[model samples]
Target: MFSRAVRPAVRAGSLAVSRTAPSNAANFATLREIEGRLKSIKNIEKITNTMKVIASTRLTRAQKAMEDSRSYGQTSNTVFENAETKAPEDKKTLLVVASSDKGLCGGIHSGLSKATRRILQEHPEADIVVLGEKAKAQLSRTHPNAIVLSFANVCKDIPNFNDAQAIADQIALLPNEYGSIKIIYNKFLNAQSYEAGTVEAYSEEAITQSPNLSAFETDEETLANLREYALANNLYWALAEGHACEISARRNAMEASITWGFGPEPD
Candidate 1:
């Protein structure tokens, strides 16, 4: 019943419809892929949420410790400032750098390492004292000849004053050949940022140059005792700061791992 012209028109219509079908199918496939990715992200959000909660809980204790030590550390430094005016002078410098033994804490290790490297580059002749295995390992590679002392496996649980004492003793006895001591560690500003600061141990020159010592009333014996106390307190503060940084780093790393579809579940 159909004419020959109608037959050719029907064939052309069928060909056009076939050409459009693949494109629509491809679009649908792409949509499905995107949906899968979104679901994965949601799963990650849940894990990160849990981790954030846990980190927040631990952060309270760490923050309290940090706050309590700040005053003690400052007072100790003031005492050192008073006594350093009489200490003997030398020419060599010793640098004490602290870091965490573990990784996966967002760039905590790398950041500390980078900062330490910059310090080393600035003072190429200084001797290095590294705390934590990670620091020892990294500095070993980047500065093979600089490291004079290293302490590893120091963070088992809560870092203690005893650990600080041990570290302080080592630093205090740096052959008495070194002119000055510099302690470098991450200063925790907040959850998201840290500053690497190098604090020089109070020295005779520092005391003479300081303009704020007139307020203190102390004699030589008391001044010497204060200097020793200040050194220990500084070491304690460094340990506490390092511990806080480790927690922050671990939390950040765990969250990142969750985001990247790692860990227990994958959506």
Candidate 2:
């Protein structure tokens, strides 16, 4: 219906558009892929930001509680430290390890595991009550027989008096009747620095038998109550502090993981 000259021009224009269509579709596909990845990165950024906020809030509250607990624990145990309470000879020992049940933090759980192994090497006969599954798994591999009790679903939040009390009650029910209880936890030195530490919760007998016990005021029935209370108090402090360490370590590790979103590492 048109002249030959115009027909040739129209056909050439149609061929050019046909040749470019695939490239346009390919470009759109590449753009969509890039967009999907960008969205993923953005989502991760949001998650990272949210976690940072949560960690900061938790860290603040944990620090406040830890300060109060630390003061209380120090004050409560000052007497025992002053008296130099020593466990009796040849009695069973209970190691109450304070660690979290989860992962994602750098060396936080492993540090406690290594420390626990070292302690086991030193006191091969001592029994242990692991507070978290992370430590339980590590210790179970080599020292399964030594693990008497293990509690999970711990360290998801800041520890309170009730948590400590419950753990202590279970420990008290154990038939071993340990001469002394030692709590090993990761001590939060700073945001980036942590190390394993131990706090002793002496038995009622040790408390009464302390060399300088007579120096304190007279109390017949209060010694048992004090022993129980101090055990809970120490556990509360250790759990709270160790929880803070985990949160701090997780926040730091998460922050570092952001770089991985860029791409694969260079060879």
Candidate 3:
């Protein structure tokens, strides 16, 4: 009888152990699911690494071009500064805004567009010239009354002096037709950061009032020559910066795509 009672107690303990076994099995299953996700993320990281390398190579070339053009840009600005001193009193302000044609660079295009919008709000009557499709699309919605000169697909391909001249011609002629000119573009500071620089054409009154007239010692003929040079240089700077921005954006997009398993192959 005592042996029979002991057997019943043993059976009760066995039932309790069996009940807890399923919980341990469930925990193991959860761990396996987590491990699978981690493995997927690792694969994605490898692809992103490859893309980053490619982008970095392109960025170096773009940086060299930007650096090489600095002196010319400074000289051109000096000429414009001098011309502003003698420019006529009545002139409309023209705003030229540059942005990338495509998206996915993590706030670059949007930030540039936002900066442009702020400038437009500040100068309500300014004529607008857009260098990229993205800027044109975004600005057109808000500034319906602002005149937009659209340049499509200029950001992706190699930008040359002719491209710069075309844009500069449009900008330089604005003073005769409108009054003054301004250029808004992203100055590439680093791979991750850019400064929104606004280059404005100074009015005659503003130029006369300013004390910094000593830098420009050129006559009318030289001043005209410098103006052309400066416009071209400015356009070149904008293009170089745009190229850097494109690479940065593509790198960022590739990273995101890798993380999500949506981008092209890493090569």
TM-score for each predicted model, relative to the true structure: 0.69, 0.82, 0.68
Model 1: lDDT to the true structure = 0.70
> Which TM-score value belongs to model 2?
0.82
**Number of the top TM-score candidate:** 2
**Which sections of candidate 3 miss by over 4 Å?**
1-51, 79-90, 172-176, 201-219, 256-267
Query: Model 2: per-residue lDDT, tens digit, 19-121?
Result: 7765446433588899998898899777866776777677878777777778767877798988889988778788988987768677888788888888878
What clash pairs does model 1 have? 105-249
Q: Local distance difference test, per candidate?
A: 0.70, 0.83, 0.69
Stretches of model 1 off by over 4 angstroms after superposition: 1-54, 78-90, 203-215, 260-267
- RMSD over all Cα atoms, model 1: 6.9
Global CA lDDT computed for model 2:
0.83
Clash count of each predicted structure: 1, 0, 3
Evaluate residue 261 in candidate 3 and report its C-alpha lDDT on the 0 to 100 scale. Answer: 69
Could you give candidate 3's per-residue lDDT for residues 66-183 as a string of tens digits? 6765555666666556544443446566787877676656666767778887877867777788888877877888885785466777767556677888877766555346445677
lDDT of model 3 at residue 147?
58
Worst 10 residues of 1 by lDDT: 81-90
